[model samples]
Target: MKGKKILFILSGSIACFKACEVVSALIKNGAEVQTCATKNALNFIGEATLEGLTHKKVYHEMFESGSYLKHIELNSWAELTLLCPATANIINKIAAGIADDFASTLLAANDYKKPFLIAPAMNVNLYLNPATAESIEKLKKRGVVFIGPETGLLACGVKAIGKMSEPAEILKAVKEVL
Candidate 1:
């Protein structure tokens, strides 16, 4: 991924911390990464941490000054987009054409002709919900690649699916996508 430009989106999920590792790996391997986060995601992982890793501001608001058209610019800048620790809410909103926030709006602006990928993270039951399932199918049909919510112990203290794929696996997927 040397010199590849990536736009990484972080949604609310406990697994959001893992995205830091993903970003670090990308940078360590010579890719340029820019991050956008949901408000709830910032709650889990501080904006400074993201900025510190990427050396760029963490964008979270669609209407923020000097960024009214940032979504379009970000999508246009990226060679690929990665939404790691993608929450059920973000997935559903994207599938439903809701661009209510910077992250979702940026996702909405994506042409999908580029490689866009998501790594789901949520409770097992929520992941399996029919609505969420349908949303996944919808995105898949639109040509979005899903990494995983691999079967394993979850943050909710139960062993099942909905665990975010590890950073190494995510990096592997990103490489494959590129």
Candidate 2:
């Protein structure tokens, strides 16, 4: 994966905290990483941590005056986009093509033919909700791939399939696609 540009989008989930490991793993494999955190995801993991790990700017907004139009540039820059610890809310938003935030905007701008991976993390009920299922189906039909919401203990003190998969597992999925 040398020189592959990986855009890691952290959504609003407690598991977003673990994305540091994913970033580290990707970098260790000689991949270039750029991270973007949703406003809600930042509540759990600070932007500094992501920026520090990526050694590049962490985008977290839709409208900002800067060197270039970030949303469009980032979509073109990334060779692959991975939504680690994708929350139910983010899934719904992306499936619906909502671009309210930087992450969602980048997602909407992505070419469907490009590699896109989503790893959803949410409670069992939310994971099984009709909207969630529908969103997943919609995204799947659009060619977005899923890593896992593995069956295991969750942050909410429940044992179900809504847990984020391990960083190694996520890395493997990324490798397979890229």
- Compared with the true structure, all predictions reach lDDT values of 0.94, 0.89
> Could you tell me every candidate's TM-score relative to the true structure?
0.98, 0.96
Indicate which candidate wins on lDDT. Answer: 1
Model 2 over residues 1-178: C-alpha lDDT tens digits?
Answer: 9899988999989998777899999999999998888899999988889888889988887776782478788888889999998999999999999987788888888887789999888999999999999999999999999988899999889999899999999999999998
Q: Write the residue-wise lDDT of candidate 1 on 1-178 in tens digits.
A: 9999999999999998888999999999999999999999999999999999999988998888999999999999999999998999999999999988889889989899999999999999999999999999999999999999899999999999999999999999999989
Segments in model 1 whose C-alpha atoms lie over 4 Å from true places: none
Stretches of model 2 off by over 4 angstroms after superposition = none
Candidate 2, position 72, lDDT: 81
- lDDT for residue 31 in candidate 2, whole number 0-100: 99
Clashing pairs in 2: none
